[model samples]
Target chain A: MKKRLYIVLFGLAVLIPLGLLSGSPAWGEWDGAYYKKILGFIPKGIQNAKSLNAPLSDYTLGGTNSITGYYLSAFVGIAILFVLFFVLMKIFKARGKSEQSA
Target chain B: MHIPDGYLSPATVVATYAVVAPLWVYGFKKLKASLDEETLPLIGALSAMSFVIMMFNIPIPGGTSGHAVGAALISILFNPWIGFISVSLVLLIQAVVFGDGGISTLAANALSMAFVGSFVGYYSFMMCKKYRAAPFFAGWIALVSSSVLTSIFLGIQPIFWTLDGKPLYFPFGLKVTFVALVGSHMLFFGVVEGIFTALVYSFIKKRQKVVVA
Candidate 1:
């Protein structure tokens, strides 16, 4: 199961660049400009949205090719998820051990 | 669907967070109980799959695009709560590090794409367990269900929060949101999710049996 799962993950990661083929954003995930163009004004809240400056905003690194940025994002995201689960497992294991000893 | 920050009203944000907080707590407990040495790698891999799968955007005939959530595979393999928590973790990473989603709307996004998607897929699979195509049905219905909830969240903004005839947040009404978001999912992305879930589920199960044999 683990082996097959990783194989699928790797296969999809290899095709990650295909995700960038669509220039159009997902519906309702558009920028403030979209609202301005459609509704003739950007929604007040959206226009003044307190958006965080994400490190890899839209999965792009500054001054890098899009495909490179995408591959890097995939690797980083997968790594982060694996690390997170690994850490959580360790924490849970430690807690279980402590409780058993107690 | 990843609802960006500021797409929802403050009231909606607070309401979604309030509703999801207890679910997160309960789901976390369930996740911890389910996790151990053997299941760790599997769960981790599945969660990573969910994250990476979302990167594969399938553009529909319309201008926009969507992708499969992979919630059904995890939910059917383990349980809905585990699926929920795992996918929620994925969404958190997307929101914080990648900005694919919004921090303020994390609860809303999690509720729709994680909690709703997982539970819906799980129950649907259970109902149709006798059928060979159960995973496909589960994945299709789960994604469509998530899209429905997302449309509702976005659809209600204009009706309630408008100021001087201008929408304060998402401008689309239920009619438009349903037609665009839900319609697209039902037609395009839902099928993609169904195929993905069925293919992966059968592969894993088939390989596991061979290994045991």
Candidate 2:
């Protein structure tokens, strides 16, 4: 099962660049300009909504190299998720040991 | 569907977080219970797969494109709560680091894409387990269910939160939002999700003896 899972993950990771083929945005998840053009005005809340400056916003880094940035982003995301899960597993294990001793 | 920041009202944000908080807690407990040495790599890999799958935005005929959330594949393999928690983690990363989704709309997005998608997929797969196409249908049903919830969340904004005839948040009514979001998912993304799930599930099942935990 583990081997199979890795195979699938590696296969998908190799094909991750194919994700960038679509320049079109999903329906309703459009820019504020879209609302201005369609409804004649951007919704007040949407226009004024607070957005944090994400480090890797839109999966692009500082450089114009989007393909490399995308690959890097995928690697970063997977690493972070694994680190978090492992950390949680450690905490749970510590708790279980403490409970057994108690 | 990831609802960006400012697409929902403040009241909606608060309400969604309030609803999601307890479920998150419960889901985490479920995740911990399932997490062991044997399952760690599998869960992590599957979650990573879910994240990578969403990055694939396939273009359809209508000048709009969307990707399949791999919630059903996880839910059918493990369970719904596991699926929910894993995808929620994926959404958090997308929101905070990638900015693909908005922080304010995390709960709403999780509820729609993670919770609804998982349960709908799990039940659908179980109901049709006798058939070879169960995984395909599970993925299809999950995505459609997620689109419906997203439509409801977005559609209600215009109905209740308009000021001086202008919607304070999302501007479309249920009719338009449902027709566009749900209709698109059914026509384009749903099939893609179904095929992906079916293909992956079959590939993995063919090779290994999966002992469902």
Candidate 3:
């Protein structure tokens, strides 16, 4: 609602779509570069400490990597929507009850 | 479970945050309005319980042994935002400290397990609890539904993202094998999740009655 916040959000909205447009066309040519850096950013050496145990290797089933991470993210979004609605309805019902009691 | 980097597609990563961020913001407001002082502690304790539960991992049928994410149960006790932040933090710890899931896939994992898993399981638990006094059905349904949904989420992981060389052509292909994989685990882990959730819920409910008196 504030001016600066709106400006930042406006910039993100414009940039995200532009990115999607560009990325979609060059999907094949994107050359999996980000994934490597992602793999590197994994704090692996920290594993030696007792605080760390799990390993962060790229998933390789059927002798190759999979591409289904995006779908999972989308599904989570749907679940969040459902929660928002369910809680809102419950609150309205409770408010109605309290008003009636008063 | 935190997904490591490169596991999810860019679309999945960005899209998930887009969806969950709004829901979380909304839930934060709703939770503050609904939960009172006594109820708040129960929610916080349940989250801690969810955190501690993950440490007890069973050896999965496959080579890896994975602990249950406990998102479903958390949602049942508190709300979605609590489940979201709690599990996201769990996934973060798994990624940053433990290196269980890739950094890229971490967001996706949080969304799927916490966002998806929590709501699906919580709603199922509520429905069952409404129709039946027995916590068994509530727990069972919560566990089963979350398992199935999460498996579907996992199955689609290959469809959205691209990681070179490792092309996943699952013979099961999110249909048959995935159902079997997700379903079989629900037999045990689902029940475990449900039982754990129900037990905690019952305990808290009793504790609340005592404190209110």
Candidate 4:
């Protein structure tokens, strides 16, 4: 099961660039200008929306090819998830040991 | 649906965070109790799959496109709590790292996509376990259900948070949001989620004597 799951993950990651085929954003997840064009005015909240500066905004590095950035994003995301789980496992194991000892 | 910042009113954000806070606490406890060396790799791989799968944006007939959540497969294989936490983590990464979602609306996004999607998919699979296409139906209905909640969240903003006869937030009514978000999910993304769930579920369970929760 583990091996098969990894295979599936790798296969999907390899095809990650296909996701960029659609230039259209998801419904309701549109730019503020979309509302301006459709409703003749941009909503106040949307216009003044505050968001953090993401390092890899839209999953692309500055000046890099989109496909390369996408592949890097996939692998980086997968690596972070794995490392997170590994750290979680260690914490749980240590807690279990402490509880048993106490 | 990855609701962006400012799509929801402040009141809505506070309300959604209140509703999901306890659920996240309980879900985290459940995850801690279940994580171990034996299951760590499997769960990690599954979560990675969820992240990778979301990258595949399939365009429908309309100009807009959406992707599957992959929560159904995790929900049926383990438990809803595990599925919820796993996907919530994925969403967190997307928001903070990739700017795919919003920080203010994280709780709302997690509630709709992770909590609702996982539980609905899990229960749907359980109910239809006797049938061969149970996973497919579960994934389909789960995604559609999540979209319904998302539509409601986005739809209500215009109705209640408007000023000077102009919507202050999402700027769309229930009718429009329902027709767009829910309608698209029901027609296209839901089908993709169903197929992905069915294929992955069968592959993971094939020729294996593994015990599932």
| Tens-digit per-residue lDDT, A1-102, candidate 2 | 678888889999999999999989998889899998998999999999899889998888997688898899999999999998898899988888999999
Q: Write the per-residue lDDT of candidate 4 for residues B13-114, one digit (tens) a residue.
A: 999999999999999889899998889988898899889888888888878999999998899988899999999999999999999999999999999999
The docking category that best describes candidate 4 is: high
True contacts kept of each: 0.84, 0.83, 0.06, 0.85
Question: How many pairs of residues collide in each model?
Answer: 0, 0, 19, 0
Candidate 4, which segments miss by more than 4 Å at Cα? A97-102, B209-213
Provide DockQ values for all models, in the order shown. Answer: 0.83, 0.86, 0.05, 0.84
Residue A49 of model 1: what lDDT?
88
Candidate 2's docking class is: high
* B12-93 per-residue lDDT for model 1 (tens digits): 9999999999999999888778888789888988999999999988888879989999999899988899999999999999
Instruction: Return whichever of 1 and 4 wins on TM-score.
Output: 1
- Candidate 2 residues B1-213, lDDT tens each? 899999999999999999999999999999878898888898999899999999999988888899999999999988899999999999999999999878999999999999999999999999999999999999998999999999999999999999999999999999999999999999889999999899999988865555553
Using lDDT as the measure, the top candidate is: 1
User: Across residues A1-102, which tens digit of lDDT does each residue of candidate 3 receive?
Assistant: 123222322342233222212112110111234333534332221221232333322111233323332222222322343344355446766786898899
Residue B182 lDDT in candidate 2: 97
Best by DockQ: 2
lDDT by residue for model 4 (A26-73), tens: 998999778878888889998999998988889999989999999999
Candidate 3, B1-213: lDDT as tens digits:
343444344566577667767876766565656555444444444444454455444544533334455676567656656676667655665465444555655655665666666677666666666653334444555445544644564557545433353323111136753555456556666666666566655654556678779
On the 0 to 100 scale, the lDDT of residue B4 in model 2 is 96
